[model samples]
Target: MKSTKLIYMILPYTRRELPGWGKLFENLGGYKSELWKDAPIRTIRGKFHQYLMTLDLSSWHERMTYFLGRYYELDIQKFMIEAVKPGDSFIDVGANLGMITLMAARCVTPTGTVHSFEPNPLVFKRLQANVSNNELQQVTLHNCGLAEGESELTLTVVNEELGMGTFTKIPQQDESLISNQYQLTVYRGDDILPEELPGITFIKIDVEGFEPLVIRGLDRTIQRLHPVILTEVVPEHLERGGFSVKELCEIMQNYGYQPLNISTKRSGLRHHLQLTKLTDNQMTENVLWLHPENNLSSRLEKYFKES
Candidate 1:
């Protein structure tokens, strides 16, 4: 059971105030390093939420900012809500505090389930806390990092101010606090998925520079599920990692998926997942792809012809 008892204590107003809180807790002897503890419960939108303390998180504003920033993009939720079939499963990689995971959990409720993974232990704690607080029994949280294979790698914390992080195949050239780095355990989704996860129907991938590596690990899963894949295409980041946008699309196509630019006008339910190459639209950051079985291409073509 989740520990929902409230700790009515003062928060540190300055850096100097932190040590006392640390010492008081440390003296309790139950405070273990990097171990997760249940926090006071709060309510929002008629849902009770548990605030998880994560050392990796820079500040409280980090969670607030992430939620507020993506509030306007309700479109992502709409797609899953409309497209997901009963008993389907959704996978979220680079789940970062699980802003999208919460939505997936609610939409795929009753029969469907959500499998979310976050690399940063700090972020994973918050994600798990939120899931538990909301009583989201259908969403399973994994703390493991996703990569090309089951291996070890170093991850760089981008900046506390930006609340972002990145992983590299090799260590950074120069070490700096802004580029705070840590060695982490990595596993391929192909190798990591449990034997019993229901067939995945949708997937969202946004692992910064490590997208290719993460996708490479999921080739078998992608082929088997033919799930709708929503991924971010960072041309510069991919280029830095020796991957190109073209190569990424080709990889998806080989798995029987077509790229569907969300910017295009929609005609039918099926068009929501069609792959439309966005070579012309340079302004957008990410585009989605749909399996041909989803029938988005034909719906789009018919609409364009009629238009």
Candidate 2:
């Protein structure tokens, strides 16, 4: 058995249901990650494909996927599979380690194209490695980020997983906490994407608190393509970046888009997500927005258990 598995064996299978207990078990096993800080890379087979990742218990993304063989968010994973069809063009903003990008590659097939953007150079390297290891030819990766316009900006990466990155003017944290900053270039999706990669049908934006800027950058493309967008909408993250949930909702509404909250069940072996229309008062962390004119929801009605 792999060393990582030995530590993960005690971790809860139903992570969402038993987070506290899971952590207790992990602590009992000394899997607080000091144990395998230098462990060898392991082969982990996921729902979509296998990954050659350096498995670690410390990284939340890895820990959940290590146990489940997929991303922690079951609904978003299911939606990506259902929403993106073969020969469709999909974009992954803030692609992280290319977990979603890898899955999208499988869905799109060789005929389709998947464009992934990652600003953190280290994470981008892993993203490139994963895509190459999987030998997905349809994917085109950019080492920079997309934004309202072309400009140089600072990227703040706050964890080992490199998923919690932000371009926001963040508040002052403790001096002891570790953060790495890098200068990155940003481009407007309108000025470049349409001419290079036309016919984009789907986009997933998880750019920490910079979600609003990304949407603004791709405003023209969204108008033209009316692609299905899966964007993160955490209120705290938005506030850190000087954005608000109300502003995000208004922006989408003005663009003729409606929202459905994306989340997973509390506990389940089979991970299938049902989409329901979100009300104005609902607090949404992740929202899947689509234009009524495009009528995209009509085609994917099986997934919606609207209440």
Candidate 3:
């Protein structure tokens, strides 16, 4: 009964998606999956996308979307929409439930293609469903992950968050935190991708702590295509993949790329989450690597003006 009033706030946002949450009145003392949540919901954050998300309200990725129209990285969406275009092959190395995949699919249309890779069987099902429901024929889903080379790795998923699965095992004091383990197939970027997919326009790779290996696997492919790469770059996460932040940047810089400070966090009550740049010292998580030779300035000139 504590959230009686709060239920009203969630009701307006989640009414139809909830299949009638007014049933909350029926069971004031308890909460059940059947009473409020249902299978396959139209995500508020997606473009009317039908997603088979978990009923767990504690998951930030799933929960935040209930309150705000969009959660997750706002800048990532902004960058993808602006950078991607029709008739361009966009690659998502670690597509979880096809958020960016769906965005790229709409951006590319049927003329182009989207190659999305998600190795987790549970998460792949959700990602596959989103693509199928939207009839995104241009998207070719791959139930695998990118690594340094062709091999099988044990993926660990915890706390029912499918997006959090990773090949790099986390050292934990309590093993009970590990909810599940899956043997997943992985490969090098150049080996798996068809030669026909030349000149990839953009790639967004976020494979938890295995980002460095994924980047290494794409060494040849990136050198050849020089696509704009949006990647997660946590220092500790890179260490898990046997790399430092400096080493990762060196690898990218060797391929003629430089990082750009795209967006930063701002105070909530005082201001909206406006599109702004973060100082180099502040940018520690995600980095957008631009290729000077191949990247079209026109694509981002509207958002980023030259000094």
Candidate 4:
């Protein structure tokens, strides 16, 4: 298992040096094979720890690759593991399959708590199964979604891509591909979490295009806790949701948070972290937002220096 993990980590970087081998591997059924057809539940080690993941090969091939460490987002996962402490409280919005949620659960164990929210009934079931299989007692799962207000909203689930579920209010071009639609309850974060959570340190948001609504709901929570946030920033998706990338960034800026580009470049056996101004285009899927007053930057610096 460890050897396989090392190969998955090194193969991507090695492929850059030997470009011709890509074709050779493709000819050997490497990319277009039914590798995970029979495997529904696979246990793989993440960058920080090992956990079980429920797989849906039908619509989640990319996510299955992530679980296998073949094409995982190691840098983002590493940052999350380093940012959370043992007693910290973390919130995972759009916790599909509990990947980051499980990582955060491991980081803040015994005394800490991880609150994960997933709206899609099918995906929530998988997320629940993963959490239960791992026996993460510190993790709490919610079946409803969060938005600026409390109301019923239409959630459209795409047949081929379950992860692409979005609010029907959002104007998505792929409406014809929707397989099912369900009315789900949406709540404001402040309303659900009335009291200040203990030791709140980190929050992750990745709700396809409804990020603005999610942030709107967490306005008071951000003002009070000021946790380090990691959120997806897809321009097209935001526009579909009736907002722009600039609008999202400005909203975070209002809460005293600055957007920084989180990138990873390989250097020998290490993946070096690069924090710079957000200059990348919409292709950069995720960005880290940190409050000016927080010590997260210094803490990350210390972690990388020692590593």
Candidate 5:
């Protein structure tokens, strides 16, 4: 068991050192055969680290393997590892398969707790399995979604792309693509109050296009805790969800949150954090929202400056 763990940890580094080694490995007859063969679940070590993921070679899984290269959003993963402190409370809204949740749990170990919320039953089961297999004691999994209110919403699950599930109302023209629609109960962050969420320092939200609604529901939490937020800023998704990207930025600005572009440069793990104006054309996959009052901004600035 110890040897297997060591191999998993070292495999990522080995791939990094060899450059294109992952592609070469994937092209091998033996590795290609495993991908084609029928398998319900196959545990694979991450490309950048020892993180384990149980995949079924579905669209989402294949996408992760090819595009993400197993690490899954390397920049965001690094930011979480560096930004989150021990004992700090982290929230993973739209936790998906527990990738960020698992990473955060490792960063804020011993005393910290990671709250992961995933509404999709099929994806939620996989998330639960990954968290359990890794034995992440710091993670607390929730089976519901988070929104602006405590109402049941229709979740459109795309069979081909499970990760693209959205609670937002879909347009009539695109309704034919929905594989299934399930009723999911969503609760506001304020609804949980100080008891359920105590001193939340960091939050990562990626709910397809429901980002604004989720932020709307967490207004109270943001006003009080002023947690550092890492969220997706996809304009099309936001528009489909009945909210504009401009509105989302305005809401964050109203709450004293400043938008910054956190990108990983070509030179190693260096992060370029720049105060950015949220424009429609400037839409990126992820952006960091920082509160001026919190010392986190200064800390992150210092880290980047030093690095």
Candidate 6:
């Protein structure tokens, strides 16, 4: 089976009565439903085979919100077309539903590898399903969460709807929420260092508010691999976790990284911040960092050219 053809099987099994299935089909067969009209789809093609998968595309308003956020939302298809080397390794720390994992797998085709870690059970199930459905041969999925220490930790559900969880100390006032909360297994990066794992060239961390903890665990690994790390650092979340944005920047700088000023309007590089400004009460959603003295400007120039 060709790699491209696997996308057609990248589907979620459904028990829910879809509009075009069973009894519902009889009533809507001739109708023009918006759901079907705007169904998300992706096409994959290899040398001689092609396949299509139906993705759960976001609404226009949701997309607008994503655009409003200064985050690097790469073009997955184009990324697959370029950038990924044959033997590179990519790690996705906060892989939600394996969207970026799938994209990473597609880009790192042939012999590259992708390590995806997701802790939320609901999202983890979906991620596993997507990885299997796509028949991604080079992707490895892990269920354990990463943090500063290796131990069993109680994670409070911050947003039940989005399945976001936090491992920070929950307020004593929120004991009721903690009672029914789920506890997850976690491993420190020092316990499983970069030398132990395969070579890692890229890492994406988006553990809502847990970035500092994750980095603390990976201090040695970062010094060793020095992979291009993309992390989201929300100030409020950091403060709640006992850190601040300035401190986080200092931590990254201590590890030899310079903060990259990501643009809020477009997918282009801006002037890198020589020194990031932050207040004791300042809050920003996301930021990107690159290794100091790294020729990131030239790299981005080359990447945008080839990509």
Instruction: Tell me the tens digit of each residue's lDDT in model 3 across 1-307.
Output: 3543355456453434344343552344124333333323334435223332332344545544553344346677766666677888889988987777877887777888889999999889988877887778889999999998999899888666668887886767635778899987899988877666633478889987787788889877787777888889887777766677778777777787877756634353221222333334444577888888875555676565332
In model 1, where is the ten-residue run with the lowest total lDDT? 1-10
Per-model lDDT? 0.60, 0.76, 0.69, 0.72, 0.72, 0.57
Report the lDDT tens digits of candidate 5 across residue range 1-307.
2322233344454335345544544443224333444534557766544667777643435434533445446678767766787888888999888778877877787588888999999889989998898888888888889988899899898545667799877778787888888887889977763445434488899998999999999888888788899899988888889988889888888898877766654445233433343444565679888888887765566434221
Off by over 4 Å in 6: 1-84, 170-180, 193-200, 264-284, 293-297, 302-307
Question: At residue 129, what lDDT does model 6 achieve?
Answer: 78
Q: How many Å off is the CA of 31 in candidate 3?
A: 16
Q: Which is the better candidate, 3 or 5, if ranked by lDDT?
A: 5
Model 2 lDDT tens row, 94-189: 898888888888888888899899988988898988888878899999888889999999988765557777888767762234368898889987
TM-score of each: 0.68, 0.86, 0.79, 0.82, 0.81, 0.65
Clashes of 5: 0
Clashing residue pairs in candidate 5 (N, C-alpha, C atoms within 3 angstroms): none
Mind giving the per-residue lDDT tens digits that candidate 4 earns over 121-214?
A: 9889988988999899988899989999999998887765566688835445666778888898999977876465666578889887899899
Per-residue CA lDDT of model 1 for 183-266, tens digit only, reads 789898988675455534778888776778888898887776666788888876677567778888777767876565554333
Model 4 accuracy (lDDT, Cα): 0.72
The residue-level lDDT of candidate 3 at 206 comes to 91
lDDT of 6 by residue, 1-307 (tens): 2322232232221122123232332233212223333434332222111221223323332221122221124332233334345567778888876656766776667477888888878667878877887788888898878998888987666533334667776656655654246678898855653464443367778886788889999888787767767778776667768877888877887897765433322223322212233333442454556675433344355342210
TM-score of model 3 relative to the true fold? Answer: 0.79
Clashing pairs in 4: none
lDDT of 5: 0.72
Cand. 2 Cα-lDDT: 0.76
